[model samples]
Target: MLIETMSIVRDIPNLNQLSKQRLDWLLAIKQQDFNTLAAMCYQSHVIPYAMIRQLRLPKSNHYEKMLPSYIIQQVNIKNITEKDQVWLLSNFDALVTTQECIIFCEELINTFNKGRTPKLILQLIQDKCLPTQNETYWYSLQEKTKDILKKQFMISSYYELTAISRILSHENTELDLGFEDHERRQIHSRTMFWSNYSSRFNRVRALLPNEIYRYIETKLKRLSPQIECFDQDGNQEQSEVFIFELSNIIVVEFLRGELSETRFFKNTEWNAKRLFDDKRLSSAAIREMSQMEVHDHLSTWQYFCEKLLRQKLQVKPNDNLPYFKGLPPAVNTYDAKIGLPKPAHNFLSERALKLERWVELFWSAEFKTSKYGHQSGLQLKSNLYLSKALIAKQLDNYEEYELFIKKAANQGNPEAMWQLGKSMLLNRKSDAKIRKYGEEWIGKAASFGHVEAVELATRFKLAFIPYKVSSSITNNDETDIKTKNMEQEKAANEGDLDAMYQLGRRSLLKKGDLLSDRLVAERWIAKAAILGHEDALKLAIKFKLPFVKKK
Candidate 1:
């Protein structure tokens, strides 16, 4: 497929935005062909969900159904050599432990790459207590050989990038599983791997010179990313694509020791603060640093890698950081196109238009005034706002975060309320400011029974009663609280045992209701017990309320 003739593939983060049945229509369009995917293979973080959704499309063609498998088979593992195969079968160990072999195998077979016999054999011996264990094998390796092993592990990390590329090809399917449980496990593994190992990222600063890297998290984002080619050019033609452009520039700046600090950390010195502020260096960084220092990701990786990164940034090798050798380079061939040149397309624009329509409806004064008449759709919109807020928060875009979170909170969203309250109180004192802006929102969220919000409210002493305490709750002129009180009293008087029990419990929380007195609470529960409310009977016994004798 020629690059120029190919239609540039705009980003489509999720195909499920439309029903699965529509994938056939997309496949029929023939726009997302092999060559049109403009984003370099590394920036394909948005491909998995698209792949999984395509796999779920019921009317998938023969080509579509078998694509994931076909892509995996493209990598001829047989070229790994007989000796290497025998070593894996006989004694060679992978970066993952024997105990973790099952998890690693699932990761390989179910999602990333599978159908290799050596990998299967390796999995088979995971529980067999091999004579040459992973620890033993690693410890026995020559320093050079150990470096090689580390490199191999790094190679394995790109497996997902390859799979995602095949997905973006829009020409493939998973051999066995698409985005099922095992795929989720792999996502979790990758996230943990990145988060747990970031401190020692300098150990493999070698990889920084490479064309691409994967985004650390974003397992469930609709228009998310996966792979990013840090050196790719001319990708920011559209205003929306600046994110991709800037992310790569950051990588470049970081690698060249030209990394600048964000304004938030301007008060801190670059000498010791850059890596900690990186929100976890990559997990691979930690592992490599640990491998070099003879300690683990959390320990030596933290202690030594910080110094190494600092020295590198400071532009002088002070002595300690100049010596450590990370593991060897990866044996696997990176088949992904490092910098596939192309332009933007309308695929994403079309989706963006659809999203724009929804956004307009959400923000329009007329639409906001008119009932949307759909609870599920409204909830989805609220959640979308919340998700945007979270993504904005990650990027330190306070304006977008505030805008989205406030929109969601105004819709009575508990999560938005919780987040909003947290934001207000995050660094501010528990003074009049919190009471004015933060406490009430947190209280509203807790009143809606959001457990985390409830906890936060309690933790910060921000909680307030949502319902007004009146002389007679059942007759009070407030909103729903009065209606609920009226309904409970009516049902209790009408001998509804469940309602009777609820009224009894409500009486204990406030002394102004129809059943407000403790004596009345006991009476109602006792009556409910006689009327066959088992829970009421239990409550009576537990509280020793007139129906059971005190032991």
Candidate 2:
């Protein structure tokens, strides 16, 4: 009855393609009739082979004993698809005896050599099948894999290196071949070690002999004059210092040459042409040579040159070089005594050290302040101090930040003034005198055309109006107040909207009966609103007055 049912379903297109003999084999496999399949295997291997390829057999070990014989007898290695091979390899432990599995793996290796099988099959054989075997078996498979990779490397073209690299660099497990350690070392080597070739070939480079490394170095040196054979010592610290010194010299020379050639420096007023031309200029002269506009350019050039030098020298960038002593030793060393101030040197990173060195070298305050016009000197000094203030802030050195920012502000740096003002104002617990000082600095910054400071000053001015009015009323005698009110009333009667708004605002602050004050304030604001004063109009609306503006 089941056979009859299968026959009905077998008329579908997939089953329709099979011949009657194959159809009978498929039906037998579905029915789990191993005895019939064994009998069918005796007649011809076709039905057994077709069953293995087309049918999804049960994976239980019950059929394990029977399936290996069918597979050995029915399947031909050259005729099966790689998918079929993978499946067979995956279940090879159950499908074949240990000896037969070895033979199957050898066949798969031969298939791989002929480029007919993927490396995954070999990986599966190595990872899944061989690990449980005895030591001899495991070592034998590892040796075979190693030999295959070595032979491939010897003959592999540039394009074929990736395939070999993948086979060697399995993520799940490292292949026991000699290349893994070498690949790792190459991975952690200076990026310049593989600078001659694409980084994609790093694994391949590890496979290269010393002769190839020498050849690459020779070629690199021949191509690039700046590149030197500095890697022999393998002291990365020394190499870093060498490169740093070289880059600094190059930057200094390049900047000097640029300044000497610049037409701006040749002007009679600057008198800087001779200063730039001196080969043995003092450090003071060097700092004087730098202008505010060239600071960014100098930084960019130094970075680019340093990177290029490191790449050429086959050295990695070492941020933690204890050997580098270009600058004087930091005197901020700690003392063990309790209650003494701790030094900030421990908190300064390598970047902060370099920033300090840069400020000391090129941006120091030793320049002639009156040589290149007073304003230019002050502007340059302000920028340099601002740079120092930013670095100090980054290091959380509040004292240094305040000191440098004050210097910059005294030099008329608007940004520094604004920053100082904002910092002072942010300290809400400060006394009124400090607050007023902060507000005065903000006003100064606004006068210097700082945009944010301008907006902030307008808000501060409006917010301080009531305070100013109340303070004046409190400080002045009744005679003085009466005279001020009379002058304000006289100005308001002449249609001065500012005077009208002030009068209205002053009435609202008079500290009397609330109803009378509001009524008096509303009348003055309404009169001002009639004259198209924006603030008076807003105040009138806020008071809920019934006044309309004139067209």
Candidate 3:
């Protein structure tokens, strides 16, 4: 049955493979359709049997990183036709399908944009898989695939697949309509979260599928019995059925209660295990998790932003589309930037409290230290600042919040500078007082590689926002000049788009007795402009400069 199932998939169009043994197995199998082969591969223990017989686990825990071995089993090229091979090559990428609202894998229907043959397609996917390390070569393969999808296939659909891949990889798939660049970063962060989360679960002998969300949803809907438990001290606390729904993931958290520890089993051949196991979680961790849950609300905000941005401009994300450079800002400083705080809505506030309770329970510090201790000084100061800022925001005290921002910014926190910049830039009046602080905040944040800061500074041509420049004496001092120069140099090395624009403007306008090489400054600014800096775009159009845009 296994051999017959494998054979059908081997013959499926766009399923690239060739091995004599696999061909023999295919000839032996009775299955003839791609769907049947896929079903057999999924339902039977064929792949698991192959893994046990043919492969050894790597020294490290590679189970979580493992791929389905059906792809790795030996195959024969003699039976595969040239046309069949071409079809396989054309549809080499994976596709996601749904059966009765349950997600499953299906043969990807390729629209051959890359012009690569089936043989080449096999080589590409193979190249993406390393002999040893799993993280060895992901981005490069993703980039190559993205290029092909953009130039040849339907770009939009390709992006949807990419997004699906992210969810499969258990990465955050927050789609941001307002800020694509900002949201793309969260995807990487989500990948990190999954890696860490899986590693933690693996230590306790808990077997997890690659896609936890989909698996959990399917299992619960099928009435697969799973047990949940809480960890307290050493002796087993209790366990209960992990009854959850497919709609929302809130079921995962609904499992806390008192029950006797006992063995339980269901229709599926599986053993019950403790949800958290013997792992001793801390309160600090719980707090951080709670904070993250709060932040997850940003996903909805991101989706809305994507819709708004796409409608305002003819931009489609899947086309490997670079952001527009010279297009007049549809979203300007005047746009409403804030989202409603969860505490404002009663329903949201209830959920927030539950998440917060879990966080505080898991992350409570076991010990406390004296405030006067030198080791605790920095921690104390930062905490004080954080507490004050939180209070100010809670009371809707913008003035106090602004002061806290200045204090933190002066102490060199990029996040503080970013907050300050946002506040001043959004204010209606735009007072001299606010402008001075805002420019200072923007430059400081930009110098440190803050994304929003870079955006703001480049949009407005402010060289150095006049601030309380920390110094021994007055603003005219040489030390201040040296510091500013060093800051600019550092920012330039870090590829600050606004810094380049500033350099170009200063070079072109040569104010004071200060002089810089015109050619070098022009080169820097032109580079920035070419890379989609708004100021650079405006300057390029103004001076009628000629330069090709870098991909």
TM-score of each: 0.25, 0.27, 0.30
* Model 1 quality (TM-score): 0.25
CA deviation > 4 Å runs, candidate 2: 1-354, 362-375, 462-551
Candidate 1 lDDT tens digits, 410-516: 87677898888877776455677764677778888877656566555556667556333444534333455556678768767866666687777555433255533
Model 3 lDDT tens row, 1-551: 76536646565666433343345333423333333332333333244233223223222223211222222222223344555444333223332122311111111112233234355444543444221234323222334443453344322221222222243323232332222444344433333322211211211112122233244344332211122122343433221112211111111221112211111111110111112332433222222221111222122223222333234322223222232221223321121233112223444344434533432332222113221122233433543454355435544566777677667666666667777777787788999888787887788777655545655676686554423323444444555456666766666667766667766755543324234476666777788888877777766665566766677
Model 3: lDDT equals: 0.38
Residue 134 local lDDT, model 1:
28
Give the candidates in order of TM-score, highest first: 3, 2, 1
- Each prediction's whole-model lDDT (CA): 0.39, 0.47, 0.38
Sort by lDDT, best first: what order?
Answer: 2, 1, 3
CA error at residue 525 for candidate 1, angstroms: 18
Which should have the higher lDDT, number 1 or number 2? Answer: 2
Lowest summed lDDT across 10 adjacent residues in model 1 is found at: 239-248
